[model samples]
Target: MKMKVVCVGHRMPDWVDAGVDEFVRRMPRDLPLQIVEVKAEPRTQGKPVDALLDAERQRIEAAIPARARIVALDERGDDLSTVALAARLRRWRAEGDDVVLLIGGPDGLSPTLKSRAHELIRLSSLTLPHALARLLLAEALYRAFTVESNHPYHRE
Candidate 1:
């Protein structure tokens, strides 16, 4: 059995892979995390924000695995602690369902996209840069795995 985590991020830099990889390497083979980048819609002059978001949303939807549960990361989403996330991960594992975590670009995900989310989560109350958000999310997933596996990497 394989556990897959697909992150549909908008425009993460090449260096972002390094940070994400660091945590991923710490995880066991039973859980494999993968980040897939979707092309971020360009912000052209005079173009409406809605259009950009819509385009991005389409790209994101296209990238998602049809059977996977969708988890949207948004400012207004529910905040979870490390332990809570671990429990959530445990549930997902027990259910034998893969998950796709969506991270929108500057304009953010469209309302239509958000409405389809199985879980809406917030990493923090403060607005985070796209780069930092990638790193944080990657690490959080690793921490969640550690918590579930009784690994020493995470502490209460």
Candidate 2:
């Protein structure tokens, strides 16, 4: 099954794209990894944060593939080790459905969206910039795959 990172941001810096591309290139054909960037709602002086998040939530929901397992990335979510992630990845593949990992915008994901996720996970406890988080998630996924495949790219 394929995996997609549905992030609510666009026009990331060149460095972020280059970093993510490196991991994407290494992903196996059987379990391809792709990134889906949704436009972030513009923040205005009078607009409430909730309104902006709601707009992003709609875009995120629309970007998700039908019947796909949803995983929301949140700072408060479970933090899995690389090995644990590999096992989780294996389980996801066995389930025979595409998986989508949701990364929220600057303000974060709405409670409603997070509640709908099949799993909630975090890359770190510290709040990371969205661009950096994107790169980290891409590399972590690549490392998890390597661990699963017993490749030298990952080590205990």
Candidate 3:
């Protein structure tokens, strides 16, 4: 199954792009990974936080493929080890539907979106910058892939 990271932001830094590209490039053709960038709603003084999040949510929803399994990344979600993530990846591959991993904008994802996800997971307990989170997600996914393949990229 193909995997897509539907991130609610554009114009990631050069370093992040390079890092994500490397991981994406390393993925096997049978289980390819793609990044779908959504324009982040412009935060303004007058616009409420909920409005911003809702706008981003709409964009994220539009990017998702029909029947895709949604996985929202949130601070409050389950903290998965690499092996656990590998198991989830293996399960997704078996299910044979595209998986959309959502990374919300600055203020985090809306409650509605998170509630609807098939699963919610966090890369770390500490809050990370969006760019760093993207990079980390890419690398983690790559490591998980390796673990599944017995490639020695991931270690205990």
Candidate 4:
């Protein structure tokens, strides 16, 4: 069965493309990957960061597919080890559902989106730049898929 990964993120600089490309190339050819880019509004010099974050939340929500299984990435979310993530991916695959992973803007995901997620995952307890977070998620997903297939890429 083909698994679909729909990742939502704000606009990023060119540097992020390299890492995103590298990890994406490592994913199995059979798994479909789609990137939904949401444009971030330009921040005024002295505007509170929260305002920007709220705008981001709206953008992220708008990009999500109506029927996809939502997975929000938040610092306060469940912290799962690699093995656990693999198991979750296997379960999702067996259920034959398309998974949509959300990456919020600088402030974070809105309460509504967080509450709507089928699963909320924390990539790291430590805060990371949105661009880097995207790369990490892509790589982790590739690794989890490998583990589920019992590929040598993931050695126990």
lDDT score, candidate 1, position 109: 83
Error of 4 at 24 (Å): 1.5
Q: By summed lDDT, which 10 consecutive residues of candidate 2 come out lowest? A: 147-156
CA lDDT, every model vs. true structure: 0.81, 0.94, 0.94, 0.76
* Residue-by-residue lDDT tens digits, candidate 3, 40-119: 99988899999999999999999989999999999989999999999999999999999999999999998899998999
* lDDT winner, 3 or 4: 3
Candidate 4 residue-wise lDDT, 15-118, digit = tens: 78777777677777767566677766566899777777777777777766667788888888889989999998888777776788888765677677788889
List candidate 3 segments past 4 Å from native: none
lDDT of 1 at 26: 70
Flag the better candidate by lDDT, 1 or 4: 1
lDDT of 4 at 58: 79
How good is model 2 by TM-score? 0.98
lDDT of 1 by residue, 1-156 (tens): 233443445545777777877876876778887777787777899999899889888888887876888888899998999999999899888888778888888877889889999989999999998778878998999999888889998976
Compared with the true structure, the alpha-carbon lDDT of candidate 3 equals 0.94
